[model samples]
Structures are given as C-alpha cells and as structure tokens.
Target: MILERQNFMNINQISAELEKEFTNKSIEQEDIEKLQALARLYQLYQAGANEIGTKLENLDAEFQVNYDHNPIHHMEERMKSVQSLLNKLVKKGYALSVENVRAHIFDIAGIRVVTNYIDDVYLIEKMLLNQSDVTLMQRKDYIAQPKTSGYRSLHIVVSVPVFQSTGSKPVNVEIQIRTVGMDMWASLEHKLRYKTDIEAELVDHYGADLHDYATELSGIEIKMQALYQKLNQYKN
Candidate 1:
C-alpha cells in the first residue's frame, strides 16, 4: 500500500504565521503566549512518539529472534500540525491555551501500528502495555465494538516519560493498532472522505459503500485468524 506522508509547516514558520494571525485578530497577550507554549509542547510530543516507536521496533526485533515471527508490519508516526490543532480548538469553542490543548487533544502525537494478522494486533498491544515503563492511559477496542462507520482498530493512549532538558516529563501518545486489511480500508476511506470537488450525495454514497466493505473485510480477517491458528496447531 502506498502511504502518503502528511505535510506539516516548520515550527518557526508556524509561529510566524500564528503571530500574524493573532495580530490580525487583535487577540490578547495571554492567548499569544498560549499558542507559543502549545508549539513548544509539540516538540516534547514528537520526542515522546519517537521513543515509543523505537521501543516497539526493539520488541519486534526480539520477537523475530526468539519466535521467528514479527507481529508488527510497519509503524507510522505523526505530530499534529499547528493549523490542525488551531482548527480543532476553534471548532470545539475552546480557548487556545496549553492547558486546554493537553486536556482536549489526546492525539497530538499519533502512531499507527499495522500488523500482519488480527490476533497479532492484540498480542502486540498486550505485550507493549505489559512493559514496566509503559503506562496505558486508555484503550478503545474498535475491533470488538466497531464504530458506526465500521472503522476497526485498537486505539491506546499511553503516557511515556520523556527526559528533557528540564527534567523527566510524562507525555501522552495515541497508538492505533490494526491489521493490514483494516489499514488499507481506512486509508482509502480517509482519502474519499476528504476529497474536494465531490458532491455531498456522492460522498455519502461512497461512505456507505466503504462501511459495507469494512464489514466484509472484518469477516475475512476473522476467518484468516482461525486458519492461522489451525495451521499453528498442525505445525505444533
């Protein structure tokens, strides 16, 4: 699958643009400070996400050596852009403050883990969360209870300590674990959902179709998992 990387503005560029935005709107000094603080917080978020990704890769390496199979297929990490963060804050009618950003936005540092099989998703989740240093803040098992749109993935919010110049600070990171099939469906669904110049009716139609497709793919994943288990049993 061809995954497109998200484009984000440089931190300095974002800060400059935000200053202009505040100047145009005549926002207060406190609000400006809030925006600046949020930008700086993102640096810490990026570091935390990178730390988690590295840990996962190390776990995969151990599994490959001991079990001869790696559960994780590929991992993708992203830090939320300044414009995206601002848009979310405005949409929720929340003030642009560092405190509000930490309170409301759980996915500022997002990571996606694509696995080879359905069971591998859960296995990796269990193993990762069982680590001594990793703290699992929240978990949403969409595979067991799928969304209305038929989206299926295990979402986990974890707080990992990031040793910064100041000191050790626990930073929150959102991890999304899914099978390859689920990832493929979600990737296409996201593109279709965000396509411009498309009629509203057509978009709705496509969304419904994607939901049905997701359901079918989920069924296939279950059968594949069963077959894999049987094969392992036979091998044993």
Candidate 2:
C-alpha cells in the first residue's frame, strides 16, 4: 500500500498546536511566514498529488507515474516537518531561528504547457527533459507555456532541495502555466501591478491600463481555450 503524506496530519493536532504556538508569548513576522509557507505547501502537495493520483488510478489511456528524483520516505518526511518545524520550537529557539532568513530559502513554482494543441501538453511534458543544476520536481502542462495577456493554466508543485541546517530535503514550490496570449496580459499586468497598488494617484492613472490588459487577456484566453478544445477533438 502506498503511504500518503497527506494522510498523517491530524487536523485536531494541527489546530491545537497552532493555538498553542500563538498563545505562547510573542509571535514574530518571520514565524508567521514559516507558518504560511507550511500551510501553502501542504495545500499544494495534497491538491497536486491528488490530481496526479486521479490521472494515474482512474484513467488508463494517459500515463501518470511518480517523478521521483530521489525517494522521500513519506512517513519520515512527515516526521521531519512535524518534529523540526512544529514540535521543536520553543519560546527562544524559534525566535532565534527566525533571525536567519535567506533568499532562495523558499520558492513556489509551476510548470506550463506552451504549444498550439493538447497533444503538446503531453509531448512537451514528457520529452523536454533538461540537465544542469536542476530538478524537475513536478510537471503540469497548460500551454504548455506562458500566455499572451498572460492568463495561463496548469500548476505544478515541486520540492526544490536546498542545503540548509534543515538537511538535504528539498523545499516545496508551486508553478503556474499560461498560453502566449494569457502570458502577454500577465506579464504586462505584473509590470503594471507595481505602480497601481502603491499610489492611489497611480491607481487612478494606470487603472485603465490594468483593465485594458485584463480584458484583452481574458478575451485571448477565451479564443485560445476554444482552440484547445478543437485540438482535443481532433486528437480524439
């Protein structure tokens, strides 16, 4: 029987511990970041794994297999998260630990599909393997690539391993996908986003720009989605 990582965490324990963690003296910003990181990762792990599981168990036409770079024992890993993050911290130790913050410490990433057709999702997700200081943690094909207005699809969750005192375990990540049209909108929105939210005057000034790009991207997504559907039919 396959041991599920998501299976072990008891909601009751998590809730009780969270309450306990909060109640004990002070809570720092970095501590909150750690909590949020864990929550996001756990959520993605379950959702993404379930998605892969469905494709594996329910559907036989397409193939889905574990993309294990190195075997992570489900039970052992769970123990690490629980013992190291949840249980080990005390009033002073947790506070001291938070002081050591580093970039590349945490990452959320996704895989995208970037082709004209549905078969592209499969072929690219399957064949485009790469080498270097890289690990293909997970693959999700929407395009299978970045989109135009920048509306994209497909989400991948990966554990990017980092060498820390935390040992050799890879940190989890999430990735998103978009088509060319969607990506264009998204990229512009990202460029524009920095300006609007900062200054109300800028929001008034650039609000139109954001709306224009969003509408354009939404439209692009619609047209491209139809193309994807048509492509799917052709494949069938």
Question: Per-residue CA lDDT of candidate 2, range 1-236, in tens?
Answer: 13233353554454345446577567777666655555544444344434333322222222223321111111101222433444344422443232221122222222232333333334333332231323466554443343333334555544444443445444444434334554455556666766345776775566566656666655665677587567756542
Where model 2 places Cα greater than 4 Å from the true spot, the runs are: 1-156, 160-168, 195-199, 228-236
- Pairs of residues at least 3 apart in sequence or in different chains that clash in candidate 1: none
Which one is best on lDDT?
A: 1
Cα error, residue 6 of model 2, in Å, equals: 32
TM-score, structure 2 vs. true: 0.34
Q: Which residue ranges in model 1 land beyond 4 Å of their true spot?
A: 1-11, 26-33, 233-236
- Tens-digit per-residue lDDT, 1-236, candidate 1: 22223354456765776676576577777866766776678877887888888888888888889877889988888888677888998998998878888888888988899998998998889888888878999999999999988899999999999998899988899999999999999888888888566888998898999999999999998999898878877653
- Model 1 has an lDDT value of 0.84
- The C-alpha TM-scores of every prediction are 0.88, 0.34
